[model samples]
Target chain A: MNTITHYSDEIINAFVDGELAAAERRELLAAAAESDRLRQRICEAVQLKELVRGAYPARSPEGLVKGRSGRRGARMRHAAAAAVAVLAVSVALLLPRPEPGQRLADGALSPVLPLSTGEEAGETTRVVFHVSSADPAAARELLDQVELVLREYAAGNRPLKVEVIANNEGLRLLQQGRSPVAERIRRLDQRYQNLLFAACGNTLERLRRETGEQIRILPQAVIVQSGVSFVARRQQEGWAYIKV
Target chain B: MKTMRPYTPFLLLLSLLLAAPLAFAGSDDGPKHKIVIQVSSDDARTQKIALNNAVNLQKALGQDNVAIEIVAYGPGLSLLTSKSRQGKRVESLAMQDITFSACGNTMKKVARKTGKEPQLLEGVRVVQAGVLRIMELQEQGYAYVRP
Candidate 1:
């Protein structure tokens, strides 16, 4: 059986630097498309690169920033000598050991320079949450976790999509009148334009049999399917999975 | 019983010819397919490829049939930079229709650490929630690819 292969640092770095030919790049992409591990590694590498760059914004080359490369180079030389020991210690502690197949964003030989932190400006994202459970508290707890995650991701503009699919016992939170979680869910929905709630029809049938009136799901809940299947299908479809 | 079964063979022949064309015509719309590309990284190199692939897919499927998105979190937000770095590739990608996304949580962390906001490039859109964004897109039936 063939083992799941990861991209080598050289290949990954080459690909990242846009140095690879079209054919090679396509091949690498094909390889990445076929492997989840590769995708994770690539994301990690990219993140590492961005972090590095953000942590250490490249000082404009002497001539570029101030039109004096050699002058700045001489000062950097003296500065390097003084900071060498400290830099080495920090590098050893901070940089993870490069695994054999680990792909570095810049490549194996790329300089290990610290990134300046000033470069980071917040970026926007869209997100959706899936909630399903019989217990209103548990369902609420799931939404709390989701909110926490979203709080971290939204930065300020709150650019995202958040959807909650409640079915079966999960339908209790989304009913129009008697649903306990209705107000809270609706408030979130209003604040987050991308937020939505889906309730499952299959679960509603069972609820109707028991309560005769559709389990009083909050208006915020949109019917879909049982949460587990919904999450599984989503993950299979390529969405990131968070158990909470 | 002695009525007429002569038309049975003729009817069968006619049906076969008509059905033959339908079989060829229906299957030619291409196979039902889906793909997902992972965009959790903000590396210049990975972002470029991710954007290129999105474009390539758009070209192949005329943009509508293919669903393309970039999901960035953590340091991956840097790829959304509209400026050039040591290399000039990222700027070019921003010009493309490629969507660059950053993780809200990560940005907040960076902002706190640096006391500066991360620059969101021209084509970049922020998805305040990374995991949720992925879930929504998946819910919408998009294939995931981590390039």
Candidate 2:
């Protein structure tokens, strides 16, 4: 028996799954080349997994008609196998649905307040508002609604740590200190200690060419990359998402 | 007094067990703790390892403690396809709550050349590019390792 070189869990699992990339597979193959025993160990682990799965019966007797006569058991097995096949096929046909990721900084779409508000002012909660629009007026209106809601929530003692994430068209809201709704936003920010700003980097690199640099973001605004992704990150961390 | 005595030790042990994981889990200081997985190669072997590492990370540290993202661009994007070679791995990791982001730029470029949309593996989400997505994820506090 040959001594096995140390292996990380990552490498070992990859080895078991037979998923090492060519270079990695080659590296492992070369490393294990000296040890037939190590190779066998990896193979045994993979084999053991299959055996363990096979160890369990795929169907439970409960699902089958209990009092069925002898012939039905065989037919039930066949039906179950056929059902699994159909299920596999349907799963294969299913396309990926975009459920937004947590900590959404990319402006990915996520749930806002449920149509019906659930909890009442339990405590001050951090909330992120995703704003994206090509039209300046609409973006301003979205901000207005957010301000109104934040103030309403605040009156109930639920202070909001509000971050306005403007990406793509929403970048207009943070134009170089000249957003059409700047004063209104700043007023709320000052009153509430809220952060109102553009994602400076995402805005400059992506939105700059589209809207030009002259667009004013309020002086208080700090820029970050991918406002949508930033918000996504926060949402993932359990901050409820609102797109107003 | 009799009722309280029976419950006290049980509650104490439960609290200790519950607190232990959070102590280990919440410490951000351990390990340069970043993983960046590349799914660019269409090879099933490589794709599988990339996903396995993702699962292991989530297992070792709760998913919230560690950030994971899979970037698939170019030929790697095919790994995300339901019919593609590595579809099963894509599906498995998705069930474990790992995020699979596909490359939009690759789709656009490939779709233009192939005259058809590049199919994304059933469970993968579309992002701008595998590399770009990695960069984005890294910026968002994920450690990067190209497995």
Candidate 3:
């Protein structure tokens, strides 16, 4: 008896779906004949297929004949087709399977550098503040919230890392000369080395394109390609996200 | 009629077989734990932290077990913008099953200011308002997180 030790679940799935090449199918069948495990796997796949099909039984000839009684027949056929489509979708969703790889906006996945290290490696407390409103009052309020939280952490001498990301209208806060909190930001920057300010490149580009003028950001602010992307990557890293 | 009685058991067995898959498909393990993270800042560090939270939660709960939605609006919407620095990472995590929702209101605001619609990343879904979206998700039993 030949022992098939190398077959992958993907291959078995394809075989069950009748998607395997002729040569592969023959090889799998031969191996199945020798291996109880392989045979059982095939049997289970077959049963699953049968069960799925049975859940949405095909319309019988007698039903079709009866539907031919009038315009209702065509409607019934359409309804049946719709029902089958829905059932197919439900089965697809319920199946345990890996999702297809998603294509990036740039049409390819670019290599990403490891972001967490040194100071960022498993710190006790990490927080991120989101400031997207252009209103000066709103921006200051958010800044206040950050200060309030940081002060609490500071009193405890707890190791903390805080980030403030400004994009869209929130970019108003990071502007070099126009920001109402420019002096306050400069003071904060001088005071806290752990806090970082990030500005959105897309917003700058949009501003330049619209007004035909370059917008200057605060000297302390670091320009990032996309604010949303930055936040998303940070979230994946387990950082706390706060919208202000 | 008497002759058809013997076949009844066989028919019942066949029906049971057919019903099994439907039952399995329709069954819900329990109430799903969901989270909606709000990203309102355009800052890279803030965005990174938000992304990190999502990735960590998925790792802890298993991607199939937990549902996470990151809602971006105002300046934070830039995170979902096409040219974002983290575009590649966003797309990669999205494939891992994270939902990125961009604010339609922010898009309109940006368009008005920039004279062009902000280009969003491929997998990002657009909703009316980021705050409203978060509220709706919360109403639907999702825990709200702002990162």
| Model 3 per-residue lDDT tens digits across residues B47-134 | 9999999999988988878899999887788899987878999988888899999988778878999899999898888997665566
> Per-residue CA lDDT of candidate 1, range B1-147, in tens?
977698988999999999999999865654334444555444677766776777678688764454456676655566654442412444444455444566676677678998987776555667765555665565555666667
Please say which candidate is ahead in lDDT: 1 or 3: 3
Q: How accurately is candidate 1 docked according to DockQ?
A: 0.12
**What lDDT score is found at residue A7 in candidate 2?**
30
Residue A232 CA displacement from its true place in model 3, Å: 0.9
- Highest lDDT: give the candidate number: 3
- Misplaced by over 4 Å in model 2 are A1-122, A209-216, B1-147
TM-score of each: 0.32, 0.32, 0.37
User: Total clashing residue pairs per candidate?
Assistant: 55, 38, 38
Docking quality (DockQ) for each candidate: 0.12, 0.01, 0.07
Number of the top-ranking candidate, with DockQ as the measure? 1
Runs in model 1 deviating more than 4 A are A1-147, A150-244, B1-36, B42-44, B82-96
User: Per-prediction TM-score, chain A only?
Assistant: 0.42, 0.45, 0.51
